[model samples]
Target: MLPNLDDIAPNMAGLTIFSILHAAPGFSQIPTQDESKLRTMFIAPFGRSCYAHVPVGICLGPEYFQTKMTECLKGREGCEAVMITQSSTKRH
Candidate 1:
């Protein structure tokens, strides 16, 4: 069982935020104000990239979510999963 609204914690000051986009069919979830700020951190034209952490609530879930994702990533259906990430760093 996932945590409910009442279980949500306050956004700690200076903490970074990330968004997940798998719940909505065919489209991503709306970005919160924090996400907008993070987007601004990207320097475009020259180059732009996101060194972000995936939202925990969105990533960690019941078996249903993880199972499908794991199978889908391991070449289960002619699909490939590739993530380009660097050494994890503290965000804020």
Candidate 2:
């Protein structure tokens, strides 16, 4: 069952949280072995249907890391048509 967002943030919390897997630092920090492990854990199980329904957000980070993550997910067996969204923002 899903947790109640109202309990966490009465006015601002979203009801559901989407997962966006990203490299910790950059592409260099994510070795092939680690990338494969992440894929097996996050992407592989959900497959295409789930991923397609939940948009993947890629924002902030090294250009190479963002590129690599996009490429990896795009290459997944049932994720070839997955949609990727890019975002940018500043906080004070």
Candidate 3:
């Protein structure tokens, strides 16, 4: 089930290649005000004026919810994930 990453590293060639979903872009590698890639790539998915294709990208697994966006996010925030269900209840 996963595709090989061609034109890439040999060791990683056979492994599954997927996208990362980051919120707030975590500990800055470079200041975002200067238009750092860490800031741009994560924010890219939501905008129309800017040309980022992440909105239309594939839903490959391992949705990593970095420490900055734990409680507000699903998928165990950054740990393991289990299938859960919510059932409707009749109000008294």
Candidate 4:
């Protein structure tokens, strides 16, 4: 089950902060054994180039990232409470 922010600190003794992660930054943290799998040619105004990290447009990018993050948070209490689809947080 997911946590509802409305239920958090109903007495106003706590705080909630919202964070949004852009796909590119997270994807860069994941290394590919064969970088060629992540490669894609593109032509921008500056020039033509390819991505060194996983591209945001890839169909599996978001799911793959989410799985990795879930693995990282596995066994931690309140992990599921803080996870909202593509975004996740670890209390520290």
Off by over 4 Å in 4: 1-24, 32-39, 80-92
Per-residue lDDT of candidate 3, residues 1-92 (tens digit)? 33335633454433443444443433332122334323335434665342232222223211422333455455543443322222322220
Residue 42 in model 1: shift from native, Å? 38
- Tens-place lDDT digits, model 1, residues 23-42: 42311222334554364355
In terms of TM-score, which candidate is strongest? Answer: 4
lDDT of 4: 0.63
Looking at model 3, the pairs that clash are: none
In model 1, the runs with Cα more than 4 Å from the true position are: 11-14, 23-68, 71-92
Give the worst 10-residue stretch by lDDT in candidate 1: 23-32
Candidate 3: segments with Cα more than 4 A from true spot: 1-48, 51-65, 72-78, 89-92
Q: What TM value does model 4 have?
A: 0.46
What does candidate 4's lDDT look like per residue over 1-92, in tens digits? 55466875463344354554444478887765465653666889999877766777778889988898778778874554342332224552
Backbone clashes in candidate 2 total 0
Predictions: Cα RMSD each: 16.4, 16.9, 16.3, 6.9
lDDT tens digits, residue span 14-74, model 2:
3343334444534435444443344433445657322211123323235546576677777
How high is each candidate's TM-score?
A: 0.22, 0.21, 0.19, 0.46
Error of 2 at 29 (Å): 2.2
Model 2 lDDT, full chain set = 0.42
List candidate 2 stretches off by more than 4 Å.
1-22, 27-61, 75-92
Could you tell which candidate, 3 or 4, scores higher by lDDT? 4
In model 1, residue pairs whose N, Cα or C atoms come closer than 3 Å (at least 3 residues apart or on different chains), thus clashing, are none
What's the lDDT for all of these models?
A: 0.42, 0.42, 0.34, 0.63
- What's the residue-level lDDT of 4 in candidate 3? 38
Among residues 3 or more apart in sequence or in different chains, the pairs in candidate 4 whose N, CA or C atoms overlap within 3 Å are none
